[model samples]
Structure formats: C-alpha cells, structure tokens
Target: QQQVKQSPQSLIVQKGGISIINCAYENTAFDYFPWYQQFPGKGPALLIAIRPDVSEKKEGRFTISFNKSAKQFSLHIMDSQPGDSATYFCAASMRGGNTPLVFGKGTRLSVIA
Candidate 1:
C-alpha cells in the first residue's frame, strides 16, 4: 500500500476559488510534511511545509493544515488562478536534511478562467 494516500486525483476550480488537496500517512515516525507544486515540464518545487509540532502553516496564498494525531495534512490555495493550475503533491519524510520524501500519488488541479 502507498505510504501516503492522496484524494481526488484531479480537480477543476474557477479562478479566484479555493483549491484543496488532502493527504494521509500511516507512518508516525514521519516528522516532515510538505506540499509540492509542479508545472508542466518542470521539476516539483516546494510550496509549503509543516512539522508535527505545527498545527498549521501559511505562505502567501498557500496554506498547510496538519493533524498530528490523525496523521493527515491538507493544502489550501486561496484565490486559485489560471497560473496556479498544476500538479500538487503531499510528501512525508523523516528528520533528515538530505533524505528523500515519500510522496503521495499527486493531485492535478486545474484553475479555469
């Protein structure tokens, strides 16, 4: 089974709407939870991240809500835009700066104008 389960393989939202992506992990040892955004023909870029101690984190129009007890995390994009349409991924990793992350299947979001 996948380490991280992501919901809604794809999504379509009108411009200025909110885009939400959810993920759940089965491993409690995972301490780093991050969300990545990727545009076509480019590598995934780190959008936002949260640790187990943090319940929520926000950067610009992006936000991450984490539930340590539930081992789940979600990403919300405020005011979705056409330029924001891309593939979003949720990832989990141990407490290592040079470690690779176990990523979710990914959610493709399309912001329609």
Candidate 2:
C-alpha cells in the first residue's frame, strides 16, 4: 500500500526554470518529512527536509515547503539545471513509530538545455 502519493510522475523543465514535485500523506503520525534525490545508479541522498513544526526549509537550490494541517509537502528546485535531472522520492517517518520510512512513488525530473 502506498502511504504517500506523489504527482506528475514525470516532469520536464528547461534549464534555469523552476521544477516542483508534490506529495501528500495520510498518516498524521508522520512527523519527519524528507525529500531524497537519486541519480542514475546512485543511492538517494537527502536533498532537503522540513518538520511539521516548521513551514519551510531551504538548502542551496533545494527547498521544501510543508503544510502540516494539509498533510502535504513539496520540493522546489530553483534554477534547475541539466545536472539536476534525477528521480526524487518524498518520504516520511514517525519519530517514535517502529515503521520504516514510507516513500511516495518517485518523480522523474528531466532538465533540458
């Protein structure tokens, strides 16, 4: 069962444009939200993250905006570049729960010149 749902299974963005991916979760117990970026043949890396207590967080060109009441969150890639192309997965995990991290079905992003 998919606990998290992600939209725009695939996205194409021009270089220097903004690329956005969104996800929604049904589990309120999820307190930690993280966005992971995975390049071909590589493991997913922590791109950026935000907790329910915070509304947003930014790191370099990556940013995560979260809405606790809405049980939704999004990742925004500013000034997207061709090198930024990858498969992104939004995940959540309850700090106290024994469950492993739950992830959305991954979004494939391609940035063109």
Candidate 3:
C-alpha cells in the first residue's frame, strides 16, 4: 500500500477560473500529505500540505482537502491564472521521518489567457 494515483494527466482552465485535481492513496500508514507544484525545468515546491489529523488546509489561493477514511485528497486553486500553470503532483509520506514520498504521475495544468 504505497501508491498514490492522480488523474487528468492534463487540465486546461481559463484565467480567473478554478482548477481542481484529485489523488488517491492506498497506504494507511502514511500520515503526511503534500501537494507540489513544479514549473518547467524546475524542482517541485511544496504548495500546500495536510496531515491526517486535519481534514483540510488552505494557504492563500491554494487549498487541500483530505479524507482519511477514503484515503484520498484533492487540490483546489481559486482564481487560476496563466502564471499558475504548472505540473502538480500529490504525494504522501510518514511524518517527521525520512521516508521517501510517493508521487502521482503528475497533472499538467494550463491556464489560458
């Protein structure tokens, strides 16, 4: 149970619109959930994260909704923009530990002008 799967290999949204991506995991042992955003030729950066202890987390325009019982999570972007276009990856891992994160195949988000 060490897999995280994401859908919509690509997404197209208009500027000032909302963008959503979903992810599912199979490992119950995983306690840390993080969504990363990556631009072209750059490493992914932690956009937002949520732990099993919390049902949801939000930072600015980014929000992460988590469901422990369902072992799933999703990222929501409010007011999406062309500048916000990037590859998003949902990941899971153990908390306060060095366990490698399991990443989704990735969803390429494009915001049209």
The most accurate candidate by lDDT is: 3
lDDT of each: 0.92, 0.91, 0.93
lDDT of 1: 0.92
lDDT tens digits, residue span 8-113, model 1: 8999999999999999999887899889989999999999989999899999999999998888899999999999999999999987686789999999999999
Ranking of models by TM-score: 3, 1, 2
- 16-46 in candidate 3: lDDT tens per residue? 9999999999878899989999999999999
TM-scores for all candidates: the values are: 0.95, 0.94, 0.96
Which residues of candidate 3, in runs, are more than 4 Å off?
none
Please give the RMSD to the true structure for each candidate, in Å.
1.2, 1.6, 0.9
Measured with C-alpha atoms, the lDDT of residue 62 in candidate 2 is 92
RMSD in angstroms, candidate 3?
0.9
In the range 2-113, model 2's lDDT, one tens digit per residue, is 4999988999999999999999998888888889999999999988878899999999999999998888999999999999999999999987756578899999999999
What TM-score does candidate 1 get on C-alpha atoms?
0.95
Query: Sort by lDDT, best first: what order?
Result: 3, 1, 2
Better lDDT candidate (1, 3): 3
Task: Report the number of the highest-TM-score candidate.
Answer: 3
Show where candidate 2 strays beyond 4 Å.
Answer: 97-99
